[model samples]
Target: MSKSQVEVNRFKVKAQLMQLESDPIAVEEPLQISLVQNNKSEIFSLTMRTPGHDKELVYGLLFSEGIIENSDDVERLESQLHEGERQINQQEVILAEDISIEWSRFGRSYASYSGCGLCGKTSLQALELKQSRALKPIKSKIDNGLIRRLKALLAEQPLFSQTGGVHAAGLVYEKQGELILSKTPFFEDVGRHNALDKLIGHELLANDLNQAGLLLLSGRIGFELVQKAIMAGYSTIVALGAPSNLAIQAANQFNVALIGFAKDQSFNLYTADKNKVVCREPLD
Candidate 1:
């Protein structure tokens, strides 16, 4: 399980009154992901994340960034602790013999913060071509009512409920324009991309990315999130927050259905070919 929150003492102040309380702050830590191939291993990325589901995070990240196509591309994943630390703070991914990787393209020598996704890219052209998978035809449609219900389901995340500082991503399926939550587990991280990566990793490990026709994000939809969704083959992405202009452009180019501001039983479709989303009864 991911360590979602940590207890800290704080002083709460009200007009002329102060109370000491133990607050549950969201946990954030540095996670070093390393890639291992041909008996040689190198640090891949350093990210800030909540401790848990680390292996899934690594697998999802590698797959999303075009490092490996599928679960079969990597033989196994391992973790290494810092000096005497008991917890596995560093992770290593070993590629299968049949797989070939160009580690130079990964920019493994650089470290990026959780807030930015393109920090390591050498050029804008490289970022544009990051996703190796060609866009697949989007055939899935989601009803407004089902999307609202799915959003409500996503709100049940225990980590965010306790800390209110984490982001979440869920894999959802569309059935007859209705929503179906895949068995793939949900992921919560301090970083939005990390959460998405964890969710992607879960689906990859389960070998059911196709079943996840829709993606629900707890935060705003941005270029990075859009790219990850496209890489993972999601036809639709619903976000609780607004969508960035670049995200809209990417979705339009890829023919993905992008919905934003999904709240109060209504959502704004940023880009959906043929206006596929069908609204439902007004929220009571």
Candidate 2:
């Protein structure tokens, strides 16, 4: 729908009879990201992701990796089109003059795949070395009924509905005493982390991360996803898939509520403060 889906011809076999049909597939392409400072540029990361929202991907990845503190650290984003083509496969992020970078933290020795978020880290110790702010306690209660609706909302994502091959990340917030899913802030990508990065990037650029909200993931919850959510200061996360053991531990460590296996009728809350998440009956 957004240049992220490409139609492909495939064979459909039905009881020994084969027929050719065309279907949409999520586009996967390499993005070479570089960081620029003081007129010098250096390659930051190479990741396979969907082609659209490249700028947001860069912003989100940098923010997640602790390369940049806030949107102010980014001066501007520049895209490099493939020679004579309109497709953007590379991005250059110009950083403020005063910003400092620690190259050792990246440890990227290989191209990162769309399904893997912890590709380059040498070990768990490396991740722990990066300082994350202490997550503040959630002051308001979250309704379980609202959490159950997250998956339904994500089901409406155009990219996933078209290809069924991409993961989605969305932000839900309270407004006018009612919970509302953000319409413009949702993102979809072949990689779950990239989708979340895009959402975080947009919020970072808009300086709206302080708003208390719940992060929704269309797939399984992993350690990196929890790490990213914590880095972004989100106190609650709901996913349609199961969570990894590390994710559960991290959520407990940070005092963040990690909800997984979210369905239309039921969901699992892995970790949360007592009296924080309330169970409510479905409305008729």
Task: Quote each prediction's TM-score.
Answer: 0.56, 0.57
* Cα lDDT tens digits for candidate 2, 189-271: 99898999999898889888776677889998766788899988888887888665556767788778876666665565567
lDDT of 1 by residue, 175-212 (tens): 56444565436799998989999998888888776664
Q: Give stretches of model 1 more than 4 Å off.
A: 1-114, 134-141, 175-178, 182-184, 282-284
How far residue 74's Cα lies from its native spot in candidate 2, in Å, is: 45
What is the alpha-carbon lDDT for the whole of candidate 2? 0.71
Model 2: residues >4 Å from true position, as ranges? 1-114, 129-140, 175-178, 182-184
Report, for every candidate in turn, its global Cα lDDT versus the true structure: 0.68, 0.71
Best by lDDT: 2
lDDT computed for candidate 1: 0.68
